[model samples]
Target: MVIPDLGRSPRPAPPHVGPRPEPGSFRDPANRVFHAGDDVLRALDRTAAADWRALAASSFFPPLLTAGKVCGTEELPAGSPLRELPTAPASSGWATVLRHERVPFVSHPYEWSFAMLRDAALLHLEILRAALPAGFTTKDGSAYNLQWRGTEPVFIDIGSFTPLRDGEPWAGYRQFCQTLLYPLMLGAHLGLAFQPWLRAQVDGIEPEQMGPLFRGTRRLLPGVLTHVHLHGSVQRRSAATSTADVRAQLRDAGYTRELAVATVRGLEKLVRRLDHQPAATHWVDYQHTCGYSGDDRASKERFVLAALSAAGRRRLVLDLGANDGRYARLAARHADYVVAVEQDPAVVDRLYRSLRGEGERHVLPLVMDLADPSPGGGWRGIERASFAARADADTVLALALVHHLAIGRNVPLPEVVACLAGLTAPGGRLVVEFVHPDDPMAARLLANKPDGIFPDYRRDAFETLLAEHGTVEDRLELPSGTRTLYRVALP
Candidate 1:
């Protein structure tokens, strides 16, 4: 059956209006980000404007922009209407506007896998290394400044680049250690997940918090002794020292631009050397272990392909519980961009490494728990957007995921369907799989549960819930008859 266009139409782009300041951008007084309609803009003060002019004229910037290592940026014409918006700095009373190429998605470091975060850290350090040689350095070392274009990491904060002073120490040193360096160390050395720690404190793990965790021999690790232990000690000892006093002391001690260059070089070496291999999880090999006969697997693939093709090309496709990324890659064939969301970090890391090696630029893998996804946080919960806030997918692939949410997570089947429906954009499609209660996978999940629980876990109930959310355009029962796939079109 053909998938009909439902009553709801495609979502339109943002309307053109006066520039609205981004909530998280208030911290940077010299430069602030604004959104006017579909354009992403930045307003800079007098000092920041001078820095921007120098950076635009720099020999390094053009090459980086061409290489896709940095976001594409251009200063708007002086008479542009966007410049007249009330986005000027309070003290400067004037603004220089620049438009930035928007990223496909904005994901937090906490939602990234070990490899993704490591790559971001490396990118940050690499940019710093390049900038220092050209007498420029980033004013801050914030992981938030980095965004992804598919698998590629791009530095988005052009305002951070500032001219290097004569004898000034690297101003963002402490921030780098806390945000990027420590997180990498946490994963590589301790084999611990850094997401929870970063989510708990948006500023990242403090030196003091990290230093105490490394005991005895662990303290001798590459960057521990100097960057963590000594760094924390110094911070504590100089808690009352003013910023001016510290810079004066560093200058008095013969700190020079050359020293700053050395610091960046040392950091690059350390970051490159640090490697993390997550312990293998069950989901990592799910594609091979999943109990689907060759013919059944083929049938499932054909069904998914036909459904996606019938729906026509998609702007964005979200694959929930994308284990091994087999289906996400398939969805990519019909999508402009695909976000493969999986809860297991190890599985996502493996998928990311494979995609990166293949140079697959359309599929982006992220670590996210469907049950408890990333939430809005910082400055009254609007600074960092939640996954739900950003996920407006044209097509949502929920293959082999409903049982996990219903039986494993204990979310009611209706609620599970509702959540999936909510993620689907208007006039979007939901390709979902429902496993029978007697299915082996569903049986295993139910084995530990008390008797008579989840009594409503039936195929009929699932289809009824699906109908409540949208029109079930098509359905297919696999050869095994234990699993069924449904294609629903939302209004």
Candidate 2:
């Protein structure tokens, strides 16, 4: 397959964007989040406001920020620091606003690799363990509460932190299993890709979902009996019980604070021990099948380095179709951070694991099909920003990518150029490679198409289309003139 790492717009600030109540905010009465340009502002009502004020003054919150376990938070009084916020609800019930350190990139669980999900689970467990000692526990433990800052998984929901009551069962335990544990197991143990299910079932793969996947002998795997099979059975039995009655029964059955700790510990151990031997995929070994000779590959690498140097002091970089992230890692050296998007789940997991420790300090790989970018969803369309709206980069590396997009996805070349150009900040650079008609990969991509459909997809036409969207700074040819790389700046 010809590889183009598949990888949007701006309008008015909200109130124009509607009530702009972020999706899922209605579930919690404490606060609501609003996206105002680059800042993530959370408007807190009286209950959440009081909680924030107390948490801000305490010693507990400081350590997590210092340790990078949580996002940096600043209290913004309505009229003081935040002179104006367009998305705030008009009601005077709100007490204050919080300006959270924007996570460099916001990704969904469906977009994550197995390693990313595993790390997120551990992060959640760590927060629970840490908070319990501080006289609090996260009341809501959805995987969405976390976002990636390079390779680091940092907790983003300031509202999830609520006081813990003694002898209360972990409210998020079932959610943790459904979202984190079951999905991790599905991938690590069953060799299945959990992303599709995650995308379809945003609430996550439930015990019942796993129950069908595991039958008879396969049900004997570690934690499968208690967390999936039997748990699903118990959940089915408890369907008729009221929440208050269940609580009372749990209290009577000795489900205390100690059990809560034990539960978190058990989940943590299972999460840490979970491992996946990733199966080989067509594109995971990108360099081998990417149709590049050693010297030609090195030529593209040098071209990318030159582009980054020209772009200079890039705060953000993007690697589209970053199969195993060879170029994303190279871009990471030049930018403060990088988001690498790939379509193959196995490929994403490979790169995600490679980014551990020092490698993780700069690169975050996500599973996103280039043809279909993530869209805004939830309460209003604005709750989640489309990938196009949020993934702006100072420099973008679209190496070996456009041919597949134009040929594989049937997107017009000019439209493809414009789509990529829009992702770049004005004055930002795109180092995009064009695989010519004669290149083997390009021919393979074109084989399925009817003739004359993409007649304008040639190098000269590519330069013209690029000129329509941005200024072509330089063009570097590799593959002995069959494939060429264009460095362009958006108009």
Candidate 3:
């Protein structure tokens, strides 16, 4: 495989078995992403090929990619596999195809903490500001166009860029307002958490929806007054307005080139000042109560490091139930990137903020429930990916997490092992903690349940299930005697 500017990534690209259309790339008719072997190729439509030419000549792409502001992209070779697809258009019509460097892991906006969302909002505006001088603008401002690279947010969708035109209201103005600004305002000013709302609606809070949430005096805030309340009022009253008429009005309403810059600057200022003090949650300080003595913690850390080393030190690591990211940080020391996912948003928000404040570019904190994980359900039933489908980590860590799923959640032992196995890539390592039923934590979890539910809950039985998929590389019994760590190698 060819290495690129992003440095070495432990997660290998998918093998180019043949040209397969990417499910989520269908909405943008201007371009479609295809997977040929391990490479992600974006085939431009006849209309978009010319747009690509314009973007390439803008002098904006090179610096952005070099500085890691945008996703790294390369022009596809003349004989690239785009021609192999049965639906390939006439080769003479289109002139370019773009290949994007695949992100190690794709976490959705719903999974991001407040800080992560805030950073994405700022980055979106940054791109808008930078591209203005180049005479280009993003046609769509969906949060999905941005992805996490370490702790920094980077724009990924090149197809979203389009040439700016005079006297036209920004096509994506409403989109930026709804997807980025509104959510931050809701969380920062209204003190409402964004996770639940963002989780339920991937498109983010709308002006009509968020505007109504602001009560009396809060609605008077400058940002809320203009972007939310006024915009929503206008949107509601435009039901009977003809699309052409509305366009005509916007065209004549002095939406000059400078107006676009002014709009972006206003949004940037508003987003930059947004803030909220996350309230403390039960799991926020749970890591401190861990009775894992110095020896236990030290032993656990050693075991995890060894497991990563065994796996060729994979760049991507997924930690399920990463409360405060204790093991997540340890994993990050050896891996290129570690995704610390916890069900509690408050804890995740704090951990995310900490990582950002320290400029640690190796960990991404996200919210995810082990019991009811995210599913794939969007446009054409594939715009969003299920957690299991996208979690292709080279090594999966589940320290102090299995008991929550097995006893607390009442999930079967074999099912739990299978789920963990599915999360790890084939031949990848699985580092997990097995809490015996006799342990205080496990006993408390099963206190309300009947004993007959978990017949194979013992460590011996757990190892048996793990053996079905991978060999046990190493297993350690902590000094506390309540927990055991296993580094299993999947076949």
Candidate 4:
């Protein structure tokens, strides 16, 4: 009933069925994104509205739009660009759509693996390249705007691509550094995982902040020099200047569409072959050096597969601290969507490479340290969502993760259970591993720290705490006498 009348006689009114923002609500003020009659309309402010209409009319946006590779959009109100721009929907708003085949899961930077982040950077650069000839530039370059449409990256917010004037430095330069450049540099040169840092600084790492973190070589890299060191230094040095001059200077930098596209391509090349040197840590052995016997490995695998089956069909599975996605693959079978999160850059790199080769779009790998998750704290705290805000997951696989939290990190089992419960969707499942004190992994983890403080950390205590949130789904002893697996479901 919501079909367009382009091919037929125009109707007097368009039926408005979808939810619309309440009048007077100032949500998304930057671009007036609201609902008008069953359609999502982005209201252009009067000042830039006419230019935007011209840019939209050009050959640039329509190719991707008609291909359905991008979101549906159309111009309206003839000659009045500020009025409204509407888009057709296969369904309704993003909040309530279930099993929505077109748009799948929403992912955040903290959840990206090295490759995913790198690819996203490449995609952004590619967009910049394509937009240059048409005199358009990406005003909003937040990583959130890039979403995976299958294996390839697609820009979601159509409003961000606006007509570029003669000489405006890419408006999103700082954001590009924070989200893409700094993180990529850390991962590539310093061998540091960007997830932990990204988690804390929601907006992104300031050049001033990132400058101090870099060792000598990080400061020397050419890409680092032009993009991070020099760029950030200039911004800080010029902080005293009035806002109008800075904007004008940036806009008058003689940065053409070609230069913008070239800059993006340059970034892509730099990120593709970045090499990160690994650091020494106890848990770093989770993949290669862990002294797990054959039996211990067998037990963990069996338990993991069982838990996966328990998740059943059409699951959005979350593998917390998913080192190299070894256990993530177990749940992949039952899941239509899988998000594998880990703290180590090395492990995340390996996992991403493997998944990328397989062309598996459903599994989204992220680099994250569970203890310090990404918090929402930028421009009014609404720029990015916190770890909990992003969690509407149907199931969580926290294998071999509790030991780090309880024994090594000093987190209580009850609080851990509480955190896990908070992430699961209504009636969602949680499959976690309990490592006994005698377990080799647990013993090694505790070896570095003074440990009798966690005397209450036992299987029974974990079970009791987990019971407070959900019923126990299954439990199996791992090959190691000290390790076992437990799956729980919310009552």
The TM-scores, one per candidate, come to 0.95, 0.88, 0.91, 0.76
Cα displacement (angstroms), candidate 4, residue 395, comes to 1.6
Q: What lDDT does the true structure give each of the candidates?
A: 0.87, 0.79, 0.80, 0.68
Model 4, stretches more than 4 Å misplaced? Answer: 1-57, 62-103, 110-114, 149-152, 186-193, 207-220, 228-292, 380-382, 447-451
| Ten-residue stretch with the least lDDT total in model 3 | 1-10
**Where in model 1 is the C-alpha error above 4 Å?**
1-11, 88-92
Candidate 2 per-residue lDDT over residues 221-268, each given as its tens digit = 888988898889888998999877787888888877767777889989
Q: Which residue pairs in candidate 1 have backbone atoms (N, alpha carbon, C) closer than 3 angstroms, thus clashing?
A: none
Cα lDDT tens digits for candidate 1, 1-491? 01112122334666655678877788878888988775778888988999999998999877888788888888898988878657453474655888888777778988888889889988988888888889899988988989887789999999999998767677778878877889999999999988888887778889879977997999999899989999999999989998888888988899887888788888889988888999998998888876888988999999999988997888889999999899999988898788999999999999999999988878889999999999998888989888998999999999999999999999999999999999999999999999999998898999989988999999999999999999999999999989999999999
Question: Candidate 4 on 278-331: residue-level lDDT in tens?
Answer: 554544556666666888788778777776775566356788988767777767
Top candidate when judged by TM-score against the true structure? 1
C-alpha lDDT of residue 103 in model 1 = 75
Q: At residue 120, what lDDT does model 1 achieve?
A: 92
- Expressed as tens digits, the lDDT of each residue in 248-271 for candidate 3 is 787788666777788889888888
lDDT of 4 at 88: 28
Which pairs clash (backbone N, Cα, C closer than 3 Å) in model 4? 16-37, 111-366, 112-366, 167-251, 199-374, 296-479, 436-482
In the predicted model 2, the residue pairs found to clash are 4-401, 5-320, 5-321, 6-370, 8-388
Q: What is the TM-score ranking, best to worst?
A: 1, 3, 2, 4
